[model samples]
Target: MVLNLGLLLRIPVAIGFLFFTIKASGQQRYFAEKPSISFFSDGLVEDITAANQKVTSIFDALNGEIAFLMNVKDFQFANKLMQTHFNEKYMESETYPKSSFQGKVTGFNANSSGTQQVKAVGKLTIHGVTREIDVPGTIEVNGGKLKLKAKFLVKLEDYKIVVPQVVWDKIAQQVEVTLDFAYRPL
Candidate 1:
């Protein structure tokens, strides 16, 4: 008996399928059901701080793909008036209900232990505007979990978040944004 050309072709195809399956099955995924996003605006009148807990995000340990979803109205402030102004006046939450970020972590390796520095470069959508940015962040992997943290400054004008002249000085020209997420295996 001799091997046929058809059989040789099928052999390579089967091997390729097997390789992909094994590779995908061996790699793990991580996710954050409830991430935390905070923004602080230090103003001349008073300091304003707001936080949102209903942020959802996902991370692929093997591919380093990262995504985040945040509801604009979910942000809570100590002062209800401030919250109202933020949603209605600044963010227009009703018009733009959601904010998102889609980016990748370069050279991300979850198997490595300790802390690692990575830059998330992608589009960040806020206040009905999208801009490409590179955010520096750190990821700490211990045991079976990974904790990601990042902080950066965002200019309100960059996203077309206009601040009225009346309260211009009351609010900071730039806003400080912070992200904290704890991811578990998926």
Candidate 2:
């Protein structure tokens, strides 16, 4: 049932991502300082969440182009053990220290005020793996500043994150990811 649910959600998102990736290109760029990304996992045994506020991104307001960079080691969790395991075991932070996303926003307009619905299509790289994704989110422009937020799901196995058999039930197969990027014009 869970597998079916994921497939159902992924199809439309994939289609939208392809459309937006193509639509965003060649324009003036905007940049985000100290952007934030939060990762949440709800498992039968435990719910784990972590936030990284040291993210940096470059985005184009006119053409909808965007790119984000972050350090995996910078992600802070609720406890030290989880953080240690995530870095040394699951994420192999020593081996793969950085993660990034480079993409474009579809149908973006900086001049427009209020909140606008948009689709972001880009390549998200984590733990040395890069995958193409398209996700729906909202962008709010108030008095010239821009704010972008989105939430998406990622499968651990797809990124080659192998959990030990003993702790399989303690972890979730999918992780929910959220992003909050506040941009400043250059």
Candidate 3:
């Protein structure tokens, strides 16, 4: 009877250990969901400069999902007129609170070295319209951190965002967006 009890206890212990080992090994990726990403504009004459952008994504040693957020309030303007027009006419922040991108890393090879440019194909939803887009960007993995940088152009008309003729001269037709992020595995 004692032998049978000992065997039962050992069986449970072995099962528990295997379960934990599988769980630990299977969870190899980490993610952040509320990363801050932003865009900027310099009147209608000059190009915009976007900086200090943040992003939230899930990535392992292989691949993951990434989502971006754009705060309309973060945009700075040279004058109040441009700001008011953007808030009231363009973007319609009250109706559409945020813009987002959801996608996965395609053909990712984490072992790559130097400056490697990869194609990230994903769905971008802006102003409630979701569109599939392929963006070209560079991914550099150094130490244990991954750095990503990409620039893409978004058309206002595609998202049903209309720029009034009255303020047409004040806004650019196409907005240039830049995204830079540093990710660590969890």
Candidate 4:
């Protein structure tokens, strides 16, 4: 009698647990479309005096594959040396071509409101090397959209990128990268 009642209660609880788990898993699999990401650089030394400003990288976020496309022609410099050296020696844009972050937003709430700080942990690939990085940023939901802003530092050595000795002083060992995203639900 007592044992039979316990078993009867346990069965329904187990079923309930399985139902919720399936629903949660389905929620995570849902995908967002066309999330945009952009990055800027301000580390050029000689170009500082020449009033050079460059905005690079406009990446698109798909379901799984994050595609980053940056036009080399978009970069501007005061002199030919800076342009040639940046593309060939420093960035090696021809060889590596692109940088990307493939990851998911954790604890994301589609109907969430106000300001929330979230941890975004994922693999960041740059210069042909991949590293696991956890970045903390605030997500603001207002007017039915998500606004995200985060700034983090990535070390050059972690990506096996060598800073030439001549301009070592000009570049910082760690590069500060910032991200600003405006996402709308699909």
Supply the global lDDT for candidate 1. Answer: 0.80
Query: How many residue pairs in model 1 have overlapping backbones?
Result: 0
- Evaluated at residue 66, the lDDT of candidate 3 is 51
Q: For each candidate in the order shown, give its overall lDDT on alpha carbons.
A: 0.80, 0.78, 0.60, 0.52
The better-scoring model by TM-score among 1 and 4 is 1
Model 2: how far residue 80 lies from native, Å: 1.0
RMSD of each: 10.6, 10.2, 11.9, 13.4
Candidate 4: residue 112 Cα off by (Å): 1.7
Candidate 4 accuracy as lDDT: 0.52
Candidate closest to the true structure, highest lDDT: 1
lDDT of 4 by residue, 75-152 (tens): 555666866776688668788765556555565555568888776777777777879888888767787665666778
Evaluated at residue 108, the lDDT of candidate 2 is: 70
Candidate 3 residue lDDT tens string, 1-186: 011212222244446335334443644443332343446554567544443333334444444445444556566556667566666777687887556576666655676756677767777877778899989887677775677777788888889989788777877777777776666655
Clashing pairs in 4: none
Weakest 10 consecutive residues of candidate 2 by summed lDDT: 1-10
My TM-score estimates for the predictions, one after another, are 0.84, 0.83, 0.70, 0.61
Off by over 4 Å in 3: 1-26, 32-55, 74-84
lDDT order of candidates, top first: 1, 2, 3, 4
